[model samples]
Target: MALKWVKDNALNLGGSPDHITIFGEGAGAASVGFHMLSPMSRDLFTNAIMQSSSPTSYWAVKGTQETSARVATLAASVSCPVSLGDALLPCLRAVDAKLLTDQQWTLVNRWFDVPIGPIVDGAFLPSHPEDMLKAGDIKKTNVLMGVNLNEGIFWIYSFAANMPLDKEGATDKEQFRNIVLAIADNNATLQTELLKVYSKEFADAQKRRIRILDAASGDSLFKCSVVDFARQYTELGGRVHLYSFEEKLTSNPWPGWMGVLQGYEIEVVFGLPLNNGSTNTQAEKDLTKEVMGLWTSFAKTGTPEFGEVEWPMYSTETEDYVKIRTKGTTVARRLRSHACAVWAGHQFP
Candidate 1:
């Protein structure tokens, strides 16, 4: 309905937007990424700004039917005091969004982690988003996918605070290491590697490296689908414009000084001076203006250049993306890490 609405509206207005870019933050970005490949939305929006988030189709929450049944079965196994029946579950979608937010983030995690999704509900989202991307149905849209330099700093504070790298290191000889590794299905090798990456902070750190890991988390959680979309789309005659954000954030006098963390780019990308209690220094604002122009121009035209670099189409042959930073704007065919490359190789349902 969303894509059809856009296409129909654009057609009514005239031809589709030459650029037709989509803008979204957090889960909104995830939706935009998915919608790019969605059967209903492919050409509706041609360009996208997946700010601080991306397609997280790799993770799925347990569905209502399955989860409810499991909860019931588990309850029964424990001699559950509650009744186990169809009436037990009123269906999650029935709940109001406000109520869910007021209830806090566990529900959101359940939707993403417990249930494997966009969903296979047999209607709007009949199959997984990655399926659409893999089939090359998603290529009509170009993309400006990126994550903030401190994208995962919040997650680190939320989850990994008070823990040292060695503790976080799955390679550690500690039980805690084993526990964290078990979460990734006890892939000790991967866990050991993750410990090396997450637990160990190398001095060779580019400011964006940690963010890239969080971006990889976004990649694993949300970006894999779009990775497929970008790769397959270009391979099958579509275009994708990729970028990485390296905006500098002003540190405040808080206990811990966190920079442009998750969702912080929302203001910067749109060139809105945010209330981080810091002034948008002229240099920062200049960079902000540059990005906003590129983004909105792409939204209006399907290209991301606003008197910037020559916007290139992402092709299988030329696997590169324009790197967006305060220092410069250039087409970087590769990042130091193979995270995005590795992500593109996964199989989608």
Candidate 2:
């Protein structure tokens, strides 16, 4: 309906309806992807830009059953009458916004550990996203999507700060093991295999357990799923442009080793002068300009033409992408396929 309005009113506002692009980042990116997969929204948007998110992301995509449970929990938390069934929507609507929001956050943090995101509710999402994409339910829109290098660093940092470990390695070790077990359904064999792989990677680290868990969280939580979505979409003959945002901020925002933490692309993409209180360098400004141009041009046309490098459409054979960097932007191929393969064994939800 909103897209319809935009299409109808674009010409009056001196814009072309045919040039409409639906772009979003983070969970908003998930929304964009959701629209792409929705049968009702086919060709409503000419192009899409999804950064740091995709339909395959576990937390971003939820089941209707879980969504119902969450709704019940939120209602109960706010002292609403859950047994009313048909009357629940009106009851919830009448609750004070602040009270409802607080209760919802409390329930979300207590049980899920992650914020509530979009759910597959049969109508908007006819089936699981994997099924939808595999069965060719996605619009063949031009897509630009990618992830940050260390998207999970700040997540771990938050966990560490809130749940202070008694000893550096020992407490984190146990916690990491428990986390892996919880994620793997207490499967001893899977837990052991995951630990072994991570142990080998962080063999000489000062904080071995932290590094191991961070790697697992980042890859499993976002990167692998993103790669899977991109691969499936590309195989379906979509014009996909992938990228990796590798530019570290001049001054780190989050404390302790937040290597390209999630959403870092926002400032650079918008050509913001200050990044966490540090002034942008000339190189950073130039890179920002290039990024803005590529994104805007892709919205106008279903192609990204940036500088000397013509960013190629991602194919099953090449899996190519343009690497965004403050120093230099260049074409690079493949995501962390090896790490992704490791996560694939666990069959991440």
Candidate 3:
């Protein structure tokens, strides 16, 4: 319908139908990636930009069983029949919108699990998105994809109260392994391997456990998925541009230890005011212009060109991407490659 409207009335609305760019951040980015895969969405857009999320990310999808379980929970919360008999759609629609939303949030706010997400219904998405990308089923549109430096820090800190951080703000081996296991779908073997990697690398006292786990979470849940998708998509002959936002956040309202947590790039990318409610700094302004320039340039053309760095098309050989920072941006490769390798076949839940 969106494409139909654009085709019929874009010119009348003073927009070019042929130049549409589907842009999304986080979950919306996952949506854009799906559109890239769907045959129905082919040729609907000429370009796509996905930030802070990827089709390969675990949180981007859920099995049908889990999705159905959440639906049953929601129905029970609203005092509707779980079976719904012949009134399934009506029963759901009859629940108060606010009540349904509150119930959904309650289910979603739990640590180590996502209560809801898109599922593979075997039509639009016939198989796992990872499989589709590897099969080269996605539309051959220009693509831009990336994640923040510390994407999982926000989740770890947000759920700190429920997590097993000790008194001095550290976690023991048991607590750390259990946390990883919860996300890994209770796969003990995978959690054991992850523990070995993180423990060997950050073999200090418990004091540094929080920081160590933060990077582990980011790599397992975000960064490695980004690498896998970029590599696989490129292998299938897709033109891809990758990035990692590593600007040490200066005006963060949270503790300094939060690093450059997830979604920080949205404000920077869209030119919004900084977290301190000030955008007067010349450096911030320059960084904002550079990000927007690259994005808009990709929308108009099919490539990103910003500052002295000409963002290269992603390939398995270089595996390079533009790293955004306040000082300057440069090309980097294989972020946390060692930790990412431990998570190669262990993505679960």
Candidate 2 lDDT, 254-322, residue by residue in tens: 543546888888877776843455576777777878888988888888888787887888887888888
Give the TM-score (vs. native) of candidate 1.
0.70
Provide TM-scores for the models: 0.70, 0.88, 0.88
For all candidates, the clash counts are 17, 0, 0
Q: Which residue segments of model 1 deviate by more than 4 Å?
A: 1-20, 43-46, 60-117, 161-185, 195-219, 222-228, 251-259, 274-278, 340-349
- Ordered by TM-score, highest first, the candidates read 2, 3, 1
lDDT against the true structure, each candidate: 0.54, 0.76, 0.77
- How well is each residue in 228-335 modelled by candidate 1, as lDDT tens digits? 445665676766676667665453222233555566666676556544555767667777788778777777766777553786766666667666666777777643
Candidate 3 local lDDT, 1-349, one digit each (tens) = 7866776687898878888888888788888888888777756788889887777788788778878878888888888878737666698898888887778866663355566779998876778898888788998868898988878877775555565323444566777666677545577787778767877777556546666667778887777887788788788878899999887545556666567888888877777743456744768777878888889899888799887777888888878888898778998876567888878876464
TM-score of 3: 0.88
Task: Tell me the spans in candidate 2 whose CA falls farther than 4 Å from its real position.
Answer: 105-116, 162-172, 179-187, 202-204, 274-278
Q: List the pairs of residues colliding in candidate 2.
A: none
Q: After superposition, how far is residue 330 of candidate 1 from its true place, in Å?
A: 2.9
> How far is each candidate from the true structure, as Cα RMSD in Å?
5.9, 3.1, 3.1
